[model samples]
Every structure is written in structure tokens, then in C-alpha cells.
Target: MDMQTINTFLSTTAIELLIKVGAAIIFWIVGRWLIGKVVTLMQAAMNRNQVDPTLTKYLGSIVAIALNITLVLGILGYFGIQTTSFAAMLAGAGVAIGAAWSGMLGNFAAGAFMLVLRPFKVGDFVSVGGITGTVTELGLFATTLLTPDNVYTLVGNGKVFGDTIQNYSHMPVRRVERTAQLAGSVDPLDAIVRLKAAIAQIPNVATSPAPEVNLLDFKLEGPVISVRPYTHTDHYWQVYFDTNEAIARVGKEAGWPAPASTQIHRVTQA
Candidate 1:
């Protein structure tokens, strides 16, 4: 070909390449911005609706990542890069990764269910997967809990869902039991009356159920007093400790002596 024709061809080819590159860059930027806006809007909605913040954040991140991947692929296609072989390779690798990480995927699915069903929430005390504690964090694969003694535990989401869950904090009320031993000489009726009065005085102890005392047995040993009272779940520990103290005090004032074995053999020998 002549120099004029060859130069013209080269210039046209260069202009076409520049246009394609510019279009690809614009697509990437515009796609990214649109994805960002969508993520922001969705996050606002989730917050307004009181959805789990961790879940919202994770979902938003995943969505943004997916959009970026799609934009990158679209840009590559615009630049005349074939994607069929790349897509096949991606599919094969995805299947292999999925097979290798099946357990993790199950956990992720269970975590998603937890977020949607909301059987328990952050700060709620629950027992599941053989672990009990106040939920501190909810993640895609595991949940973090703070135990009663302040120890931290992480439970796999799949195990948690697969096992039975005991949500002690879901209800507003729980029962507290207090047991005491009173001297057999003490009148059972009087002991019961005083014990009930003392339990009633305890703060957070529920009155509707009415605390009751049962005479468990009477042998050579003193009377076994079984006391049970209902209280608000949140105040379970407070009511339990206070009620026990109150019952013991009431028993003392009611002339219920402490349990002691009598020394009768020495007196008989004398």
C-alpha cells in the first residue's frame, strides 16, 4: 500500500481505539457511582426499618463488589476482549471453591436465616449450640456471645440453627426458687406466713403468682422449706438473692431455730 493510504489507516485505527477506551472508562465510572448510590439508599432503608446493621453492611458490600465485577467485565468486552472462555473458567473455579467450602456456605445460609427470622437479637441472652450468653455480634458465618461471667464465645451459625435454642430473655418473667431449713418445733403455718410476707417485700418479685412455701419433709432433721416466687426475667438474679435473704431473716424472727443434732447419748450414760 502507498504511504498516504497506510497513514490514513493507522490514524483511523488509533482514533477507534481511543474512543473504545474512553467509553470503557466512562462505563466503569458511571457503573461504580450508580452502584454506590443504590447501596447508600438501601442502607438508609435498612437502618430505618431496624434491620440488623451487620447484615445490611455485609449485603451492601457484596452488592458493590458484584457491580464492580460486572462493570469490569463489561469494560473488557467493550475493548474487544473475549469473555466466553473467561466465564467458563470462572464457573469451573466457582464450582470447585463452592465444593471445597460447602460447610462455610451452609453457615452463611444459616446466618442469613437468623438475620431474616430474628429469633434472637444483639444484647439478648440465649442458649444455643451448647453455648449460652448475651449476643454481642452477628456475622455471616458465626455469632459472638458474652457469657454471664464475661467470657466471650463464638458459635457457628449452622450449628446454632441446627440445634435447639433456649431464649431465656424472650419472656418477660422467670421464676426464682429459694429453699430453707427450719426447726421442727416452729409452727409450719406461722413460718409460711412470715416467709410469704418477706418475699412480698422484695423488689421485682411478682405478686400475682404469690410466693409459696412447701414443707418438703420432717424426719430427725428439721423441716425442709421450699419457696418459689415469680419475678421479672431481667430482675431474676436480684429477686432471687433478695428473696432468699428475706426468707432466711423471716425464718429467724419467726423463732425457727437452726438445724442441729442433739447430743442425747452422753446424758443417758450419766
Candidate 2:
């Protein structure tokens, strides 16, 4: 071809490429804005219906991801790229990734199941997968917990769902199990009465079941007094510590000697 004709051809090709690139940019921006709007609307609707915030956020994330993927595919199609082949490639990659990240996929599946089962919600105090803490977030692949010691922990949802889950906040009240040792000379009946009165006076103790102060067992040093107080999960630690102090206070006021084991040695001449 002559140089003039070659130059014209090159100019047209470059212009077309530029226009397509510009259009793709605009499409991406618009697509992203629309996805955000859709997610916001869906979340608002869920909130209006009083859906759980954890579920609302989770669903929103899923929907946003799906829409973003669709948008990317659409953009690829606009550039005259065969989306069918691209989708096939994506499917193959997904399979490979799924195989390699089986545990992550399991966690994702468990998270979905947990959302349906509603075992525990965010902010619930629970012991799951051998970790005890308050749930901070129920995520796509993991559950975030804020422990009693102020540590944030992430536990795989698969592990959490597979193991025993104890929801301390499920019931209205939880029982704090504590035992006190009394001097062998101390009266068991008197101790029980004293403990019951002290535990009842502790703040946040439940009134319905009342505090249970009873003879648990006999130790070598003293009689064991079971001092169990029922309280809301929120106030559990407070009530627990207070109950211990109350036990000590009662012992001090009663002037009961600290329990000590006495062993006798028999000396024999053979």
C-alpha cells in the first residue's frame, strides 16, 4: 500500500481504539455506581424489615461481589472479547482455586449455614471452636471474636460450625459456678445460709432462680460450699468476682479459720 493510504488506516484504527477505551472507562464508573446503589437499596430494605445487621451486611457483600463480576464480564464483552470463553476460563480457575482452598470454601459454606441457623449473632457471648469470646463480626469465611482479655480473634467458620457452640447469652441468665472451702470445724448449714445471703446481696444477681448456696462435698481441709449465682451474661464477670469477695467477707466476719489438712503420723516399733 502507498504511504498515504497506510497513514489513513493507522489514524482510523487509533481513533477507534481511543473511543472504545474512553467508553469502557465510562461504563466501568457507571457500573460501579449502580452496584453501590443497588447494594444500598437492598440493605435499606432489609433494615426496614428489621433484619439482623450481620445478615444484612453479609448479603450486601455477596450481592456487590456478584454485580461487580457481572460488570467486568459486560465490559469485556463490549470490547468484542468472547465472554463465553472468558467465563469458561473463570470456571476452570474457580475449580482450581476451590481445590487448592478447600478449607476456605468449607468456611464459606459453614458461614452461609450459620446465617441460616442463627446459632449466635454479633455481640453474643459464646464459646465456639474452643474459643470463648463475644462475637464481633460474622464474616464470609470467618467469625471475629473479641475475647475477655481484649484480644480480637478470627476463627474459621468451618471449625466454629463443626464444634460445640455454647451461647452464654442465649438464655436470660447464666449460672456462675463457685465453691468455697470452710474450716472442718465450721458448721456446713451455717455456711450455706451465710453464703446464700451474701450472694443474694451481690449486684446483678438473678432473683427468679435465686442464688444456690448448698453443701457440695467434703474436702480433707473443710466442707465445700457450692455458691452459684445466676446473672445476665453482661454482668457475669462482675457478679462472679463479687461473689468470691462475698464468700471471703462472710468467712472473715464469722471468724472462721482457714481450712487446713491435718495428717497424723503413727510411730511404731517393730
Candidate 2 residues lying further than 4 Å off, grouped into runs, are 1-50, 53-84
The number of clashing residue pairs in model 2 is 0
- Residue 152: error of model 2 in Å? 1.7
On the 0 to 100 scale, the lDDT of residue 240 in model 1 is 85
What is the lDDT of every predicted structure here?
0.84, 0.93
Those runs of model 1 whose alpha carbons end farther than 4 Å from true positions after fitting are 1-9, 182-187, 215-223, 257-270
Clashing pairs in 1: none
41-153 in candidate 2: lDDT tens per residue?
Answer: 99999999887777788899989999999999999899999899988998999999999999998998998889878899989999999999999999868999999999999
Candidate 2: residue 219 Cα off by (Å): 2.1
- Cα misplacement distance, residue 266 of candidate 2 (Å): 2.5
